[model samples]
Target: MGNTESVVVQKRLTRFRPEERPVIEGVFDRLQGGAGGPSGAPGKTPAGKTLTLEMLQSSMGSLAPDSMVRRIYQCMCRIDPGMAAPAASGKTSTPTASGVGREQLVIFLADTMRGTAEERAPLVLAMSQHGAGAAAVVTCEQVAEFLQDLISAVVQILVHRGRLQAWKPEKMGDGSLGVKLLAEQMCSELKPSDQGACDVSCLEDWIFRVSQVSLYLEMLVAEGLNVSLSSRLAPTLLPPCRETPWKELRCLLDLPVLMFLAPQLPDSYNAPWRLVFSTQLHGESFTRVVTGLTNCGPTLLLIKDTKGHVFGGFASHAWEVKPQFQGDSRCFLFTVFPRLRVYTATGYNQHFMYLNHSQQTMPNGLGMGGQHGYFGLWLDSEFGRGHSRARPKCTTYGSPQLSGEEDFTLDSMEVWAVGKPPEPEEGEEGQGKRSVLHMDPEVQAIMEMTGKTLHSQGFREPEEDQE
Candidate 1:
């Protein structure tokens, strides 16, 4: 989920589909609808007419762009074809073996929709509670919209509920309340193909894999947008965060995206990495921070905008303060909070996203340089409002067709490094042990950026390696 490599690609990654789908038309028919008549209020359906799956599906399918269609297809793919009684009666050809996921989905829906009176599915009741007017005879579009909103609301509730109930907060050795970030836990273990149990961690990882967060980031870069993290964040979220200090921010960095796109790292350089440098992008520390970066290790950059939104990039090359682009095909950009997106480095165009443009010239120009577009990260703390990007239009070397945020606000950025683990001393046979761990208060603050904590409650001395 960190700036790691992927074992699978878009083409190779497989999506499972059930051989059949439960005819859910009846489910909609079961939805309570208000009666209509000549004397009834206008814009109502006739007394017998009601919302149905066909109407909803048709309406959804009519929307532009094939992704929606594909999403519907994948959802339908989760339906169990064998659930159709006609197949058992031989009215249909032999049914293919049903997928557990598909079958489970069907049963799950059935359970959710179970009714006490047998007059309507329990889901109908649930929908009504969520504002699906019991007033019958809604339009197909209205039904479709209601269902979409319902799903969004449900997912949001489910995510935060999971966080509140199970994930306990622990005060770290530094006395800072820390909930282990799914991102840190997943750095080494997550994979796109993993179909493990649907635990919270797994659910989080799966969202990173399947969601179009990366595509959105790429579009932003392709479009040359430099805006506040909030503007960039709203679209890529799983369940949008409307309130401040969103607890889910910690998991923003947890995504199943590989940073470097081409030219894999040499075996020796592929060792695990730990956090090193982290600071606000606007401080005077900015110059020393940029100069301090070495090409000896991989670098991960995380940026937070004034709005409390966070995003970043992973560079395969050791970071350097230079006018020219450095590093391999491995560099990529990403966002953690409000959902994950990791945009990989590319060489499609002559332009490149580079770092380091000044000496005593000081923190004025864009430090994070990008391609074909004026897009890049910039911060002059004294300026009050930093620039993330504006009207970004140039396509990246990747030339992705997807669109991105054209303008955004900037607040701060964090840069971390990935390098070989410290070698064992002669007598010490394995990895070194450290009492205090993975990230610091600044690190935790970045993780908790969306939470109520404005700053990390603790700060340990810098590591010797960093010094």
Candidate 2:
């Protein structure tokens, strides 16, 4: 009879709620005076009992700030049907689904227990994989709404934490705000596409605006402008811009001025176009000059000083070239985008004889003295020799001759600067002559014939001049 009653009691205990069953067993064991007596054992507390309320209140009080926040997040997650039941296990007395294991429920509950706002701040802004998954499952409108709320909450937190500072928008050239408010407005006004289109166009636009703001801040820093904001915000204000096709093209086309320096070119002659500047050449000087010209195209040349490195301007055949004297002497000017390759020659005979005998010895033997001579016309070779040697007596050629019938005729050639111009002599009439032009009249004429100005000195439009 005792064994049968025990079996019945066990069966009855099994029927209790999973959460309640543990407490019931404790009470039953205590009542039967098994192991611990009723007074000694922590027995089951009834729903309306003082101990039950105390236990509930204690559990609630023990929850961390993060737990509270996670509880709210779990509530948010319940939007998905699969996530709903697991989230409801905290307060419900009903039996959980077989798929919702006790361990999983405990993990969810533990996460929710850390519900304080402070604890949740970092997680809220963190781009979580789960968040991304939720975003993928949800509509873009929902995502945008969530992001907006998240950003607002973050801003509020920052403010409350005393990190908020007034940041003024950058000013444009016209003294207007440069923050691209229009883009922001568009993002706010446009409805996100619902077709799961990964058009991060809005984000891209925002990033670009931020980059511009960063640039403005850098300029301000350079100008010694005072800014109250922390320097850390500089990076935040300017994130990397997304590379669109147009941006990539712009990167390729925006050639730097340093490309014009002569030293940067390849060692051997490889450029498709050749530049023939009218200067006296002596011995093998022309070889050095040509090599220097070629070299300029490849190297990133800089003029160094104590201040810092300064970029030398790029050389191109397209710039203006005017011939000062015409006598089998024509100054070639114009720029060509050359496909260059390095020239390789084996043997000393080939290297020396090639440059000196064949190349330097112009057809008429009217070669400028070789690279070694005093009257050498090649500027690049001499410059490479450095100032340590006795300065050559050769009168350095001034700018290309601007006069003569062939003057200003344009031709397809590549131009690069090999060396810095000699410092002006004291009391010289033209103390500072920095600009050099290699004008090709042929190109100018063709451009003029086509009613386009090959080179315009001022801002006058070619069409206006034609009219």
Candidate 3:
């Protein structure tokens, strides 16, 4: 770095507020004393004091594993070479021996939370490849392993520290699988070299393109260190969740998946996620599913195929069981199991959402994207039978087949009503109520088995005789 860049890096020392400065300095001082040091000791001199890997790990609590803390300590050393304590005569200095200085810690936190993409890219590379040279190249498998550790650490912090906002992990699907899937998705974004190795240049490109990489790193540091750097960290990374029925709510998505997908939804980051339907909680009845979906506002539909392929779509509007297509361009198809990816509309066609039942001429199934019989995702009204037929790709969403096979057997499904419901008309508050009467009789039968109540019907008013 040039002299100008060096000055900018040094200026990050003042990144914390006056009040928070003491907190940061206190952390530095505590860690500098090394493990087993006196807790009430006065602040140490920043110039000579250094923090070893053991010191860093001890200060990080149990949220992050030792390996993760090692990477972070290496990152601190790499951020400023001077931070690494010089090797004594006849002694080889290892990463643990090259302790982190106060200046390095300050710049690391500042660059992670508030620095430009250019400033954080190198730090990310260092964190991912500990003890490697600045120009070291990494393979996909190496990057994936690092991501897995990072994700695991973040999930532990969220669950152990009660940061899930009342979300119950017991009611959700396997979080370990979620961690592995999310790591693969994050690794897929890396631009590897011709030899499939990710050098510093590729890492920089990735950090520039995927903003979440920086976001995750910031969260890992802030939460793992138990530091209060609110002035620098962006709170909007995970917006405030609204109230919901905690006991009744169950979901296939874990907190990490939820955190990744929540920000992707358009203008719904602050909205509540209501459990509209779930095949596990509610029996396999297409009619009951449709009834639960009506007038619930924008929703997320998730399906787990028998082959363990988990995928779904985001409905930009409330679902209505009609022959014609519904939903706006904001609608998208996504995969959750094999990997996490969202395919938006390509504008080649308008076959965004399709939900029809009981019409002989039209298809008696629910579908999204593509056209007619060749929908990107289809769920037959008969239940358990579905298909993801995308010939090269769905013209609407540009997504390929999402299920394990072209046709698949549904193992489970979930529908979450995201955000607040759209305001109803003055006299149409119970509009979706009547639509329930028109639902298939089979749905009514299975609704009992699935525990779905027909209580909405009791509130309907008798229609007066028309003129």
Name the candidate that leads on lDDT. 3
Q: Highest TM-score among the candidates is held by which one?
A: 3
Candidate 2 lDDT, 290-406, residue by residue in tens: 433332222111211122111121232122111111111111111111211111112111111101223343321111221233211222222322110113221221212111111
Question: Which should have the higher lDDT, number 2 or number 3?
Answer: 3
The pairs that clash in candidate 3 are: 283-450
Q: Write the per-residue lDDT of candidate 1 for residues 172-276, one digit (tens) a residue.
A: 011110112222322223332333222323324433543222232222221211112222233322211111122322322321222221112344444433333
Give the least accurate 10-residue stretch of model 1, judged by summed lDDT: 171-180
Q: On a 0 to 100 scale, what is the lDDT of residue 442 in model 3?
A: 79
TM-score of every candidate relative to the true structure: 0.36, 0.18, 0.83
The residue ranges of model 2 lying beyond 4 angstroms of the native Cα positions read: 1-136, 165-194, 197-467
Question: Considering summed lDDT, which 10 consecutive residues are worst modelled in model 3?
Answer: 83-92
RMSD of every candidate to native, in Å, equals 18.5, 26.3, 6.5
Residues 225-280 of candidate 3 have per-residue lDDT tens digits of: 66776465434434344333457656678866786778779975356676667776
Candidate 1 residue spans exceeding 4 A from truth: 1-273, 280-284, 335-350, 357-366, 369-373, 379-386, 390-392, 397-410, 419-467
Q: What's the true lDDT of residue 181 in model 2?
A: 20
TM-score order of candidates, top first: 3, 1, 2
Model with the higher lDDT, candidate 1 or 2: 1
